[model samples]
Target chain A: MPQTIQQKFVHQVIGHSATNNRLASKNKIGSGSAPVNIALSKYWGKRDATLNLPTNGSLSISLPGLGTKTQIERLESQNQQTDLVSLNGQRLDQDNAFAKRVSQFLNYFRETPQTFFKVDTENSVPTAAGLASSASGYAALVLALNDLFAWNLDNKSLSLLARLGSGSASRSLFNGFALWHQGQQADGLDSYAEAIDTTWPEFCVGLLEIDVKQKPVSSTQGMQNTVETCALYQAWPQQANQDMQTILQAIKDHDFATLGKTAEHNALTMHATMIATWPPIVYWQPESVEAMHKIWRLREQGVAVYFTMDAGPNLKLLFLETEKPAILQAFKQIKILEPFKS
Target chain B: MPQTIQQKFVHQVIGHSATNNRLASKNKIGSGSAPVNIALSKYWGKRDATLNLPTNGSLSISLPGLGTKTQIERLESQNQQTDLVSLNGQRLDQDNAFAKRVSQFLNYFRETPQTFFKVDTENSVPTAAGLASSASGYAALVLALNDLFAWNLDNKSLSLLARLGSGSASRSLFNGFALWHQGQQADGLDSYAEAIDTTWPEFCVGLLEIDVKQKPVSSTQGMQNTVETCALYQAWPQQANQDMQTILQAIKDHDFATLGKTAEHNALTMHATMIATWPPIVYWQPESVEAMHKIWRLREQGVAVYFTMDAGPNLKLLFLETEKPAILQAFKQIKILEPFKS
Candidate 1:
């Protein structure tokens, strides 16, 4: 076995002179923060579950200003137990799925290495509220590890590594708009992330969080059920690919109307696929439908607000910076949020 | 009101000696027969319920060999108690929706005439099945009346008359292929039916009636619910219009591939709209999805067959005349139909 270019790069980044000596270093910490991403084109079903590769391509915009901050530190004084993870100041058990996913990805590189690592993460967004909190969390871990190891991997390779942990997390690796490449290879090695363009940035997303008490269906399980049973899921790959292409062109052209149309269609298609599944499931609450109708009616009345949801009741209304006030006014008229009397 | 050329022609065909006589003879009855039409571009919602006008246009091909035979008889008998109606050899109560619809349409022309007439109808197709039995029934009544009165009404005029009773029935007024004209009028007077110039004798439809005992949701109520609740219903009208145009062109060019694609997409969109409705009603029986998937899998495996379904559990497999034998043979191999030979 010879040292690969990636391995050499990792050693150099970590200031190590030799491959064997790399593990002997005491500093195993990584990046301090990573941003959350909102999927402009949603990722629904997976082609390979183990690899977390999607059936169709998805594009997302990383919200650099709003996401979780995480820190990974090697614990020399801690017990032989592999890792201790904490989320927003609360210690999480090692058995937790999110923590386990992080540990698993790290274990891939350091075979039989000491598992004594401490993870401290703080989420800026609401947990389990449909706003890609896990995306930011997993992305933070991926970025943290890459920085800690001095792995000089590009966004694409980091995305590939992050995909094994969570599908949407791969999209969070890049800033602005990112597209998850649905690689043709069987091993999913080529399936990664790339920015659509650096210049396009007028896109602004407003989170209208409907704090419903009920928990919605998790995307991972919901999509898996849909893929396994939904008859319409068979048609989604082709339609999603077409939508991705159309949206990519629309994004490149800065056509908000086309982007909005494509996004709305994609969202409907996703929900339709869910209901078409056997033992039909619905993630929508009654309020979700109400909010959607209100937004739609406002749009029909010539408001420039577009709404999208990801496996939950909360709605994210996308609008231009200039149109935000009008959209917020319309939202207030519908009594969607508490009035700010200030 | 001055009689238009269309009204005069209708009067001449209905045996009126003068336009005034035709207008005065309010109690005159006419009977007509038109074939049941299966939609290539399906209509699922109403824009105006009182006029029975559809939200979108639909394309259908009349089944020449099968339909309803209707007879309308004018009566001088003024006894309200004596207006007996019979359908398919069974005495139908005057309060029955179908009978009431007939009476109402007649009353519209008579406007408090001296007498009322009884209508007798016989349906050749299976009633309450996925097939458009009502389309034939209503079309037959309109056509039979036009013939009995010696009214020289064109297919379009008769279709307009029939549309006042049922939206889809209007499309059945023409033979071979037909299009329902969805005019943008509040009164719906301009909406009628027109014949498409394609006589596709080479095309054949094979019925695979998966007899389910449960009564499916009525298209009328289902469509109303969809309009009032389903967010996706808004897109149906636009897509249906596009599909109708595409299918018409496909029929004209004898392009089975394009025709099949358009039909499949239209059907799927209709079903998707249904699923999006609140309370999430599904007209499909469990076996219907299985049957469709079976045929789809076979088609994917090189069988030249496509399936379309209405608001019922039964499936209609559309295939080219030359490929019917092979398609039927493949269908038999799957044992989709049991106890009956393919």
Candidate 2:
């Protein structure tokens, strides 16, 4: 039988995080929010399956307006410790796939034996819509629970904990650009994401919703399969590793052209790995492809814009804020778009 | 003004062939045939646009029965020295795209400014239908003209000549598996295809024609665009060079699995390079993706089969002869398939 999460963590927790006064701890509710991360270098496969460590290093920008707000409330005493997860105000079944995965991560945070908490995760973006909703949700939940237990852990520890929930969540701990290194450590101690404080005032995100529903194959599963198979992916690691350097330098220099090109290519590289896998995973729709082509056409007409996609058909168009009007005009020329400012 | 091609290669032709009795080389028709080669590792971008040299190497197998049989008849008389080209019984205008390309190649074979020949090309493969008809058609036309004038050129010289007409046409000169090497020379003199003559009797080609229309972007234009852009392709040359060695060894070792995996992966890599281009050149249709998935699914069920694609949406599934029935049954399961045994 599995031990209670508090007992599991007592033995597993690393040094330096001292517990607060246990005697004074009482039932309380705490709310925290985290923004969705828009990956520039792209996080695809995992290196450590148990810890959810990434296979390739990545850099991401936080979308301040889009994310999840989760309220963690300590539940009343019950016969059995059971964590409840509610998404968009609908109570999900405990045995359902999403709830089970959430519980798996939550159980590791159980600080009190025979104690449970209710997590209400409300998303500013569509849930599981390839907008990194789970990354924000898990990051927010971890943040809220840290307050509930009075565990004032540093951002690194918080980021690591978020990774245990969703790999992309590691970057959500930071406010701006964050780099998640593909660490060499087997224990995942060195794998946490670090925030890059620099900001570009002109950087803007253009979200074009080709579809809002969840992808056919989730990013986690897709990455796992691509890593195991896909021969073209044999070069993806070295390729992306070099791209990271280029994109990082571009970002530091505020070179929008170089940054946009590198980011766009890196996303395609990730998608290529997915497409080269057995059965050839594809997330592109006719409308999505059309939108990308229109963007390219707009660039030909002198619009400074580029695009990146995760595991879904949605496109995240990155451009300078000054080009917003041109980008909007280009979008107007394209039909079937439901745009949200990323 | 662009100089006529005859002036370009006048000194390059070897002098071994004394024209067989100048009087006997009259208006009699001569025929030569060559098989269409199916690329396992695809050729996408061009390193030298002027010489038609590919940026990446590719491996291919021949479809012997599906090819072109052209009849070359020396013209009785002509004042300005013209090469009238006809395809599939249609007398194509000299200024038409295909005819112009053929004329450009035929001009290189002109022994004298006044020498002229009429070329009639017939193709077993579909014309401009992604069936590589131009490859076979050009190969046969070049072969027949070589016989007509008794040029007695070696296969390397013939392959180079064919490439001037169409890039992939260079491979069709071979009887079995052929590898096209993207040589390092700037002048493209060393860039030519070599025939790997080993025959795998068990090897079979399952052709599925998804569509026969002309590609949205011609192969030449697409390759030039990809080589100019697609940042992910920065590593493609090295990746493909390595794949070339592995695939060549697999062919020599008769390792079908290694050959299949490398070929399939290489095709995807080529497609990735295209997809990563500025506007993203995509060739896949819904049915084409469905066909690829069905092939992968068949493999999961223990059928030793793999697939490759060219610039168009058609699929060429490579499998052992022993698994033909199983492969056909799986194809039957795939809807919208117009199967042709190559």
Best by lDDT: 2
* Residues B1-342, model 2: lDDT tens digits: 126443353224333343333334543677889888888877777776767788788777877677899998767576646778888889898789888887767666555556677878888775534686878887888778667756667888878777777778889898788988888877566777998867677777777777543236777787777877665566677767777889899988999999888888778778877876755677776457667656766887899988888887778887777887887677763212211233
lDDT of 1: 0.69
Please tell me how candidate 1 rates in CAPRI terms. incorrect
Expressed as tens digits, the lDDT of each residue in A39-158 for candidate 1 is 767899988876777899988767656677888877677365677888889888889987786676656555245646778889887564457777777777767766665555667767
- Chain A TM-score, cand. 1: 0.87
How well is each residue in B1-342 modelled by candidate 1, as lDDT tens digits? Answer: 314333332333333353345444444566667777888889889888767778888998777667888887766555664456788888788788777767766654442455466788888776534576878877887777666555556776778877766778988877788898788977566778898876666787776666564555788888998898665566678778988999999998989988886787677667777765654545555456556656666766887777667887677777777776777776562212110111
DockQ, cand. 1: 0.06
Candidate 1, residue B203: the lDDT equals 82
TM-score of chain A of each: 0.87, 0.90
Please provide TM-scores, in order, for all candidate models, with all chains considered together.
Answer: 0.55, 0.77
Best by TM-score: 2
In the range A244-298, model 2's lDDT, one tens digit per residue, is 8888898899899998988988888788778767656777765666676677678
Whole-model lDDT, model 2 = 0.74
The iRMS of model 1 comes to: 10.0
